[model samples]
Structure formats: structure tokens, C-alpha cells
Target: MEDINTPSTTGLMDRPAGPDYRLGAIPLAPERFSTWKERLAQWRALRDAPLYLEDGRARAARGAERHAKRRLSVHHATQYGHVFSNKRIPRDVQAAAMGRFEADLIALTPRRVLVLEVKNWSGQLKVAGDRWVQVQRSGAEVTHPNLLAHNREKLRALHRYLAHAGVNIPAERFHQAVIFVNPRLEIDPAIADHPAVLCMDDVGDVLGSGTSLGRHMAARLVQLLTDAETNATLAENLLKVIPPTEVAAATAAIKGLRTWDRLTLRGGRELQGDIIWLRLTGNQAPAAALKPGGAASLEWRRGVIGGIQWVLRNRGAGNLRGDIFWDQHLVPGRRVPLDADDCVYFHEPGEPKPSIIALSHVERLQIG
Candidate 1:
């Protein structure tokens, strides 16, 4: 709960008051980096770069000590397009949308905080509701998430965390909001039972509340986490809500097929049999055929079949310019021949690496 005396929280919504919503960040360090795997990875990334700069034959190189620097982090970028897409956004753009919320909370520096997940969608945002739509300047369309429901879920998590912290807070202080960035995109409006959301146009101004904790409080909670005992207790309690990540969640998600045991390929195959650690040799093309309501087929040029994707068909031909992967290994769903060997591996993103079944034999197929 928030009072006039209570510190404000970080809000990720857009601001109209001032465009300067830039925030300062505190760095995060891993618990430990001495693992052998980490060391090997670090070595591989730096192995080819020149170690010592060329200078005079003697110890003259020492004069350029200021030039010494640490290796740059090898970034891994994931383009988030699954939720929704439009011309305003590119297919490969990475949204630090969550980061916006995180930074805002950091500035708020509250003893307890609330996170409201809001979506400003017009259509019924439920299974049996109307479809919400967002029209970009280019006349392209996108959908907003069910922000009202999302905020409620977030509030629950925040309350759980706050209680465990022993930092007593109340429900009223936390809020949620979903705003249509532009008001011109009209829609029939409605309300919900929750008090967290604020439906508006360009919520950025309200989110960047221009509130900040002084240096002392901000720095104090910067690296705060639930104490060890609290964390352990939370771990046990969380098992009840969402099943553990290992096998439970996956099994529960799939319709009737539970991946209790591993899937083994019975048919005879060569080096391409193993699903993980596959060496892909295939031609990547700007062309491939697919049905209007079906998955786009991407042809592998060579080697063991690797992977396939259902891409946005907007490339060369009329319907088949999407980036679809045709892998050799049998990925659960339907199995069809990619080459004389590989097949399609159908899966939604974020599935754990399929167990690596022990592969046998050297080779039977012609592996390039």
C-alpha cells in the first residue's frame, strides 16, 4: 500500500510530461564466474584477438597502458514478435519493454512495490471476446495483450514478494495501467473490477511520474533480494503455483501427450539422428512454397537437416518467402521427409532442449 509518506514506484508506461525518462542503472554481477565452462567460453571469444599491441621492440609497449580494455560482452539478441506485430515494429527488433518497468521501480525505491500489467485493447480480450486491434501510421495492425488480467497476476506476485520481505505493504499502493499510445485509434471502452489499471492515451507521462528516491534509499535497495531463508521458503511455496520448470510444466502444457520419457527415433538414420548438436548443411533461400493457412517450408541446402520456422511470408514470391526450417531430426508434431533423411521439428519457442538420445553408428546417409 502506498501513502503520501511511502515512496513512489517505477512505472513503465509512456510519459507525456517530459521526454527525459532516462534512468541511471546499477550493475549486476553473477554470483560466481570461475566455472570451467565459463572459462572455456571466455577463452574462445578472446583467443583470436591480438593480446599485446605492437610497439617498439623493447618494453616500449608499456607506454600505451591506457589502451588496455576488457573484452566486450558477446550479446545474444532475441526478437520478440510473438505477442503482436505491426509496421511500426520490425520483425527483429528487441524490446526492452520489461527493462522500462524495472528501471522505473528502481527509481521508486519503495519498501514494497506493485507492478500492474495493463493492455489497452478494444476488442474483447478473452477467448470468447472481440479481437482488439492497433493501427499503425502505415495502416498496419497489431494486438494488445489482456493488460487487465496481466496486472492482477503481477499484483499477486508483488504481494507475495513483499510479504516474504517482511516489509509490510498494502494492496492500494500498487497500480496497473493500459493506455492506447494514440487516442486517434478509437474503440468502445469498458471497465473492469480491478483498481490497478489506468486506460488512457500515451501513458508515458504518468509512468515517468518524475518521482525518485534520494541517493541513500535508492542505493540501499538497488541490490536487494529476499533473504536466503525467505528465498528458500518462496521456492517451496512457488512449486505449488507453477510447477517446476523441469518436466512438470512442459507436460501440463501439451494437450494429451506428456513428455514423461524421452522420444527416441526408431527409423534408421546417420549423423543427423541426434536432435541437439546437429551440424546443419542446407541452402538458405529467399524462396519456398507454403499454403496460406499452413507453415512455410524452408529447404535445407546440405548436411544433416537442422531446423525450420513459420516465418512472416513477405519475401520474394507471392506466398513462400518466409524463413521456415526443415530439420532432419523428428521434432514432435508431424514428421515428413525434409531430404532423403531429415524431417520437420515443430515446437513453440522456449521449449527445453529435447533430451539428446544416444546416437549410434557412424553414418548411413551421404553427409556433406
Candidate 2:
């Protein structure tokens, strides 16, 4: 929620409108997932507990944000301006029928503002008329909301919001895109080549292009800044239009959005952290003992073995390995705890090194 010009404020709009102010890179949050004491306690608790690898939808969403952040930072357009993530959707904008939402990423440059929706969905996907279908690696088909259409609506809402805020930019200057950041994702012919639907790899080309799609975008953004048209000036104008209290209100609403993985211990104690490394060595249920139905039929319980693994393995996963984040800072490396078996490394905010936890004592790990 920190602004590019100042980390103390929630939004860039909170700053005074100035013609010469500049914007800096707004990187992802830093390390220090848990307090030192909390990390020690988690380590001690896991000394004898079992580990269970669980996943959740929230975790995927958070990962997608990270992917988009990295991609945007390295792209050519980044030099033009900083990309903002989780830009809170104004209540007026939401009331105007954009629905309750937060922009996944907002690319603001001198000439244009690009609203991006980041999707981390993997596996095979296709379009079915108005609906989107997800063909899991297990061959089970799932229908998803029409995110493509929704993103367009969001762009429209943003245009309206900017107009109401008195920023007299053309509606054409605003753009929207749905970026699929997952490397494992496979798109059907229906949407694979859609202009607004892009893969992470295409981000650079799109941002740097001066063709029909970006003729008015990239070229305009690359133009030298004017004394009357600095990045801070536009940003300030946008902010100045909004009431000083508006930024605080929006930040409060979206600030505590928790995306960390949750660890629910057998003792009913829940801990928030990240699973750095994990191995699924638990015995699989016998063919006869396996549930008849898919994920729905499986009993999702804490400390139970194989339920999550079965689903992931069906989707071509042999084991689970993920980044560890403290607070929102991604932990470095994926190295396993030396000489550990049937154990996974866990990290909490403030913890420097990952703690080794036995797989037997862990009830379940809900990925954030």
C-alpha cells in the first residue's frame, strides 16, 4: 500500500501535487515473516509434529501477484513509471457496477494507465461460450467466471473513476489486460491469441510496442517528461482530486489482506507462515480405500496424509516445493533442511532460516 514517493503513506495520491516530484520503484514487501520468538515457537512445535502439504486458492492469487510484479519490473515500460499492485477499487467505482474488487496491477505512465489482471491458473483451459473451462490435469473439468469480460468492465470503471477525479485523459488512453503468469498454464485456441489475454512472456513486447495496439501508449510514455507533466504531477493531480481521507479509507479496507500460508497444528493452534520445502512420502490409500469421487469426496482434515498430494499428483505433481515469504517478503532459495526425512521447512515472519518440521505432527498446511 506504500506510495512510490513515500513509504509512510498508503497511496501515491496522498502526496501533494507537484510538477517536479518523481516516482520510485515500488518493489514487493521485504523479508521478516515472523517475529524471532514466533519462529522459535513454530520450530519447537514442529520438532515432533507431522507435516501435511495443503493448498488454497488464496495462495495461487498471491503467487500470481508476485509473478506479475517481477515481470513488470524488468520490462521496458517500467522505466517510464512504477507499476502499482492491489490498487484499491474506489467505492464509487464499485457502486457503478464494477463489483467489489481491487485492481491486480496498475501500470501508470505519463501518457497512459494500463490495468492488468493477473491469473495464476494452471493446467489446460478453454472457452465455452461465455464461460471459461479449466481441465485439470486429472481430467476433471471446472467452469470459471468470465474473467476476460470482467477485466474489461474494470477498465471501464477505472475510466469513469478517473474522469470523476477530474483527470481529463481520453478513455482510449486507458487499457486493460488479463495476464496469465503461470508457466504450466495451457490455453486453447479460443483465447490463446486474444489481444487482451497475454502470457507473461509477451509483457515486454506489449509494453514496448508502438504499433496499432500501443501506438498511443508506449511511444507517448517514452517521450521526455515536461516541467508541467512529470510523473508526480499527474499522480498528484489524481490524488489531489480524491479527498485526503479517501486514501486512508481504501488502505484500511485492503491493508490487512492476508496472503500468507496458514499452518493449523493438531493442537488446534493456527500459525501463519510459508512452506519452503516439502516431500510427500506418506503412504497412499489403497485403490479400494481411495475415495470414489474426486476432491469433493475426499475428507479435508488436518494432519491427514495423501489427500492434497493425491489431487496435486493427479495434476502432474510429484512433490510440493514453494517459496517462503515472511510478512510479504519472499524467502531466498528452496534448499531442504539437511538430513531431514518426512519433514518440511517452515518460515514465519522475522525468521531468518527455515525450521524443519516432522511430517507426522503437522495436521494440515493451508497455502496462502
| Per-prediction CA RMSD (Å) | 25.9, 21.8
How many clashes (backbone N, Cα, C below 3 Å) per candidate?
26, 20
**In angstroms, how far off is 207's CA in candidate 1?**
4.1
Q: How well is each residue in 1-368 modelled by candidate 2, as lDDT tens digits?
A: 45565555576655333221111321222123334444333333334343333356656677778878877866655554556666545536436453334678876543356779898888899998899999877888999877778887767766666656545555656677889887788898788878888888887644543223243343334333434345334434542221212223323333333235555544444555555654333322222221211111111212223323323332111222333222212323331121112444567656775665544344445554
Worst 10-residue lDDT window, candidate 1: 69-78
How do the residues 1-368 of candidate 1 rate in per-residue lDDT, one tens digit apiece? Answer: 64655445456542223111111221122223234454333233222212222323212212211111000011010010001110011111143243111101100112113232323233232222444445545666666445556444544544444344343334544444443322333544443323333433233332333223342233223324555445334433441111112112222221121111111222221122112222111222211221111232222222111211111211111111222234322334432222211122222123543322211111121111
For candidate 2, which ten residues in a row score worst on lDDT? 290-299
lDDT for each candidate structure: 0.26, 0.51
Superposition error at 102 for model 1 (Å): 14
**Candidate achieving the largest TM-score:** 2
- Which regions in candidate 1 have their CA more than 4 angstroms from the true location? 1-146, 161-173, 192-346, 349-368
Report the CA-based lDDT of candidate 2 relative to the real structure.
0.51
